[model samples]
Target: MAGSLLVSLSGITARTLDGCLDLATALDERGVPLSLLVTPNAEEGHRSVSDWVRERVVQGDAVLLHGYDRRVRDEFADLPAHEARLRLIAATAALEDTGLRTNAFAAPGRRVSAGTLKALRLHGFAVYSDGSTVRDLRGDRLLRARLHGFGGRGGAGETARRNAFVLAAARLVRRGELLRIGLRGADLDRPGRWSALLDAVDTALECGVVAATYVGPAPRVTCSPRGSTLTSVPSGARLVNRP
Candidate 1:
């Protein structure tokens, strides 16, 4: 069997959401489905984007809940379970009002709390995102793909990162694991950066991994009701081979 591939674009605030949506459009044209991790409820004066998101989801694409308004902080684990769940619900509810059912949650920096995963599960989300994980909080097998390109300072340094990402991806391919590569909204601002990341995308596809449209029904296993110490998933979810 071949591995699964997941592609994500984070940081979809009001300012960058439109272009990000456009980038997603282009990817769709190429048969590469992109999931946008939208931050619901932008600060004051930001344009309301529910309509855009609604249209995206209507077209058979995914618009997963990103994070809530930057109240206490961007990460959800810092908050209590009640607060975390409520805040997460608010983000999902924003999409719900627009007739979009959210099945996944992606944190701002891929560093949300264990409570973040619980919130995602409680809110009817099956797959959890923001970082690469082989095993979800519910002990379900995840693809464990994370952003492997364009996080460097540029030039030789950036090329080094790109090569490293490709090498790491090659290793994962050999293991029959799911491949997850993340792109940021900022990546759109720099043509060179986004293009560089595309190279890594090509590397994964060439490895015979199939690009997937869905990640799943909230993990079936009962995990920690709160906090971040998640239960073990399958060997496919391990990060030992990643650089």
Candidate 2:
């Protein structure tokens, strides 16, 4: 069976909305829908971008709350359950004021504490995708995010990172496993970064992977870790730290 590929773009603020839109257009032409990560309190620019955001959602792209603010890195990384709940309430309300609403979440920097998970469960978030796993809250299961491609910071190691990411995509597709690629809004201005992402997507498609959206039903897992469980998760917030 062919594996599924989920493409998500984050860091979308007023400045990067255009680039994000361009990339979304390219994905749409290939029949791939993007899962957009929006930050409600990022900057003063969101008010201007609200209309554009709604347009994309109307076109079938999946919208998710990335974090409360872009200035705060790893917003959910170290919060307690009570604090997490408070933050979510504030963030979701801000998003609603913008005329966008979503229960799905992707934390900034793909880091989340166990408390973050508990808060998401309580808030009725349907799904949460972090660095290593995608948790389906309603279904109470975990899906390993085996292959990921993230935008590179400028440096000598950038090329190596891109190469490794492409190779990982190829391997996942050949093995029929889930492959996730996350692009940032800054990637468009970075030389070769945008092209590298396109290369990874093309490489996966050539290997027969189907494009997927995180907003849709959770993809069925062909394999899961033996003896692993998320059932005891709620009780172990402090004991089972992910960060």
Candidate 3:
């Protein structure tokens, strides 16, 4: 079997929109689907950016909920189950109102607590990525995915960091594990961060891995509700994301 690749972008506040656009242009026809991790409430003043995101969704890209507030670094990292559910509900509604409906999510830094996962299922999220793995929530199946990309923080010695990322991706591809390429929209603004993401993608393709979205090409598994499943899915139940 061939390895799968999923490319995701986050940190897409107004400040990082330009970088995100640049990276999106570069990824065109690159045989991979892109997932935009968006914060609905945070994008209130950025009408243009929101319009662009809707356009992308129409153009075949997936938009997943990133979090409620971009400034809250650990928004979903350690929330109580009830709290997570509340946030998820509010965030999902905000996205729908903005005309960007989605059923996938990726917590910041991929450091979500177990309670967060529980909330995801209750809220009818079909897929999620916690940095380490991508799970099909309803399907109760998961694929191990290691993220390789930019963090948006420009710094010295980035060449070394870029090289290390490339090397790690190559190793993961060789091992036939899922390749998760995550990038912050702000990375494009950084000196060499955009190129670093491209290099990582190129390397993975060269190693014979096929690119996909968070709704990966993995075989569909039977749906078995572990605890509580969403009693009724919201309208526009399209499943699609990354961390």
Report lDDT (Cα) of residue 201, candidate 3.
Answer: 83
Clashes of each: 6, 0, 0
Model 1 ranges off by over 4 Å: 43-48, 70-72, 134-149, 152-156, 214-243
Residues 1-243 of candidate 2 have per-residue lDDT tens digits of 677778888777788888987898889888787888888874767776767777777787778788886778788999999999999999888888777788788878758888988999899788888777777787777766643755456788888887887887778778767778888888877757777788888887887777767776544434434322232111100011113
Best model per lDDT = 2
**How close is every model to the real structure, measured as TM-score?**
0.72, 0.87, 0.83
What digit string (tens of lDDT, one per residue) describes model 1 on residues 81-195?
Answer: 6778887777766555445555666666547766766666676566566565534545464543454545626666765676677677676655555566777766677766666
Winner on lDDT between 1 and 3 is 3
Q: Deviation in angstroms for 17 in model 2?
A: 1.9
Q: Is candidate 1 or candidate 2 better by TM-score?
A: 2
Q: Write the per-residue lDDT of candidate 3 for residues 54-78, one digit (tens) a residue.
A: 8777666777788887778888999
How well does candidate 2 match the true structure in TM-score terms?
Answer: 0.87
Compare the candidates by TM-score and give the number of the best one.
2
Which runs in model 3 stand beyond 4 Å of their true positions? 42-44, 216-243
So what's the TM-score on candidate 1? 0.72
**What's the distance in Å from true for residue 23, model 3?**
1.2
TM-score ranking, high to low:
2, 3, 1
